[model samples]
Target: MSNVVVQPTGITAADVLAVARGTAKVVLDPATVAAMATSRAIVDRIEAAGRPVYGVSTGFGALANTFVAPERRAELQHALIRSHAAGVGAPMPREVVRAMMLLRVRSLALGRSGVRPLLAEALVDLLNHDVTPWVPEHGSLGASGDLAPLAHCALVLLGEGWVLGPAGERVPAAEALRGAGLTPVALAAKEGLALINGTDGMLGMLLLAIHDAAHLFTMADVTAALAIEAMLGSERPFLPELHAIRPHPGQAVSAANIHRLLQHSAVMDSHRDDLAHAVQDAYSMRCAPQVAGAARDTLAFVEQVAARELVSVVDNPVVLPDGRVESTGNFHGAPLGFAADFLAIAAAEVGAIAERRVDRLLDVTRSRDLPAFLSPDAGVNSGLMIAQYTAAGIVAENRRLAAPASVDSLPTSGMQEDHVSMGWAATRKLRTVLDNLTSLLAVELLAAVRGLQLRAPLTPSPAGRAAVAALRDAAGEPGPDVFLAPVMEAAREVVRDPALRTAIEREVGTLG
Candidate 1:
């Protein structure tokens, strides 16, 4: 966590995930109050000296050169929020909102956004108490720092918005603040612009994608192992010395992970001398590490970008060394915009391979000893046959969405805000890919576990049986063709349970 402090605002990736999942509290440092005071002081000095400052005296966006009268200063601040709360489409998930609020709070704590201590605290309170602003999901160029959605967030601070109470009632902002014993936050100096300008929303989404994809990465490795079990394919490819000669850290990690996954399986030992295993496995199964490892490397970089973003003040009019604020393009999200799309592609490929393995398991000829469609009574009970089809359909849809959103940009905001980073869409797409991939892997896990269970007397490798046991805890063995919805739900539940994941790790040891 301290590493996050020296690098960012001292908030780690683990912190955001905990907050996003509603399991932690948000507390800013006392020094953060001091930081806010300093930032606000710089703005006060500029105003007292009668020097023109951007966002303080000057207008915004197309109206930047126009000066605001002292009489309308408060009006201007409120107007900035009101005018920009034009977000459309679905409401953002509360977890994402909480993450955005915490992200913004940390950015302000860096002493750069010119917000006061209370205004920053209001954001922190929302995260802590779960009084999240009902920010709309759509309407962000991802350049100009996610204007519309963030404006809705700022509106809540100004005592104007729809807020969800802890009991799930939607209350008007004015009463909500009063009922919660919280005061309405007034934007002073650059606070209005700061509150509504930044990629916290996008950053929150990116952080979620990074975190969820990381868990899914481990899941994918396990899913591949299950596929190998079902296919009764070669395990020699995972030999440590083979990958040692030309080691990529990721390749070495994956080989070791898969090797341990199959370690004590009687099935693999049975195939030890088969020339067919040497002839090779399918590209999807054989090249699992190569394809999945690249995704892992991509994730390493994405994690750094997201962690840096927590402390980054991605808004206009940065406070410079001499207290002169020059409006820079820090708000433009090209860096993370491209990263979100790249991650989408990576996550999509994860689903792609997982679905193929699902296909391999379904094919009677390919899945030796396993009944076709994993059905004991094939024609009478449609056991898991359509489940593979569903997984395939979602995987194909993921491919279509994987087509980079960054590659297609449209001019907006009267051409002033042209070349939008559609980074919001990319972030959302990565989120979608994560959801699809998890559910797809769920199906593959179910089928593989079922296939391994069929060969009862012969125990699977130690790691394989442990992986199966983890599944058994969540879902008992399928006795016959039962309603698949429960099975799918159970599948998703296992993929999500942190305890089950730890159990698998303990049994299998270190994985890629």
Candidate 2:
């Protein structure tokens, strides 16, 4: 197994995905161990001196004023973990659970959490052994971190929770530990609090969403170019000088991709000087770059937020260099919540515009004289009429999912955490939006590919032809529509497959 070295300085988004996908092992650096030891000493000294540190000698949340006897400190920590492990709903996916575990390990390895190196090592062991805790879907308020979700993960380290066995069967954590040649370690003074106090759950989901969106956004550009050709839309709007004046980074890149994809197109050249067919195209065709470009810019902002979070130390009562433990609000999820919400809205717009293009490709009046619904026999075969309905349905759902989750706040912990980030919900909906966007783009691709075929001997540009040929291979030639669901699913797979992007890139270099 390839190793991802952990350090106090933290890791990247790609590294998080690698460990989550079970493609890499996690190892702590020697220097990181040394840094952890230095912070552990501070925690130990505070305990010895009987200081009422927030997560050490005193109780948590609203009970912080309550002090526990030193002899019962172990019980205090254990109770904290057991009580907080109250998540409800379906078990989270294996990759998401793995991602949460990996991110929590990174947070602890930063050394400010004051956890013993052994505690952090146990998390690494779970990741390397594929022993994932069965975390539930709900329970985070996104303030003071993703408490319940991380507590479920922390519970497994104490041999007191359920975990997915080697083959993904749910088993006792103790049994899983023994099967992996490992034993659960007891939590020390601040160890349990450290284990659960971070934004790992939402952050994990955000990183995974970013990874998937990168591919989806590129494919949107590809699908849009095909739709423009299918509709015989003018390529004049994508000219370099037109976008250069605006100077939005993503706009210029998107315009360049569309402009390059339409170059040398016999269809575009056939209508270049035809006054009859060459009035301004609809907004869906002419303004695709503007919409997609704005989404890309939003994604860039979300990436910046994720990058900052990856290196942060998000624990309460962090160990300071001067031998003091200070309580801080570093665990709040507001920053992540806002970013996730923004990205969700941006992605929904991308899908909305793509759906419009799909609708246009199916309408005879709008599709430049192509058969209605791209059907061989408009009335005999219902054709792709329902496919447009599917796209519209998905777009409606995307709009609902795009509502900002960051604006929501529910009080918890006896109203102690009165303003929560709702970031977990934000990231969750963002995933659904991206999923809908993929299907929405697939509908456009299916319609667009058929529209190109209807154009016949005019021939599309090299890049457009490459994309059309790839879709045709998966979905069959665009003739009479048969078994629409399977063909639509095939097109969805084509959108997801790297092969479509590979074919297009081969003809037009790399897309922006």
TM-score winner among the candidates?
Answer: 2
Best by lDDT: 2
Writing each residue's lDDT as its tens digit, candidate 2 over 126-175 gives 99988889898899989898999999999999998998765666799998
Q: Across residues 326-420, which tens digit of lDDT does each residue of candidate 1 receive?
A: 78787877778889988888888877888888888778887766788877778787778989889989988999988988767888766777787
Give Cα-based local distance difference scores for all models.
0.78, 0.89
lDDT at residue 432 of model 1 (Cα atoms): 85
- TM-score to native of every candidate shown: 0.94, 0.98
lDDT score for candidate 2 against the true structure: 0.89
Error of 2 at 357 (Å): 0.2
The clash numbers for all candidates, in the given order, read 3, 0
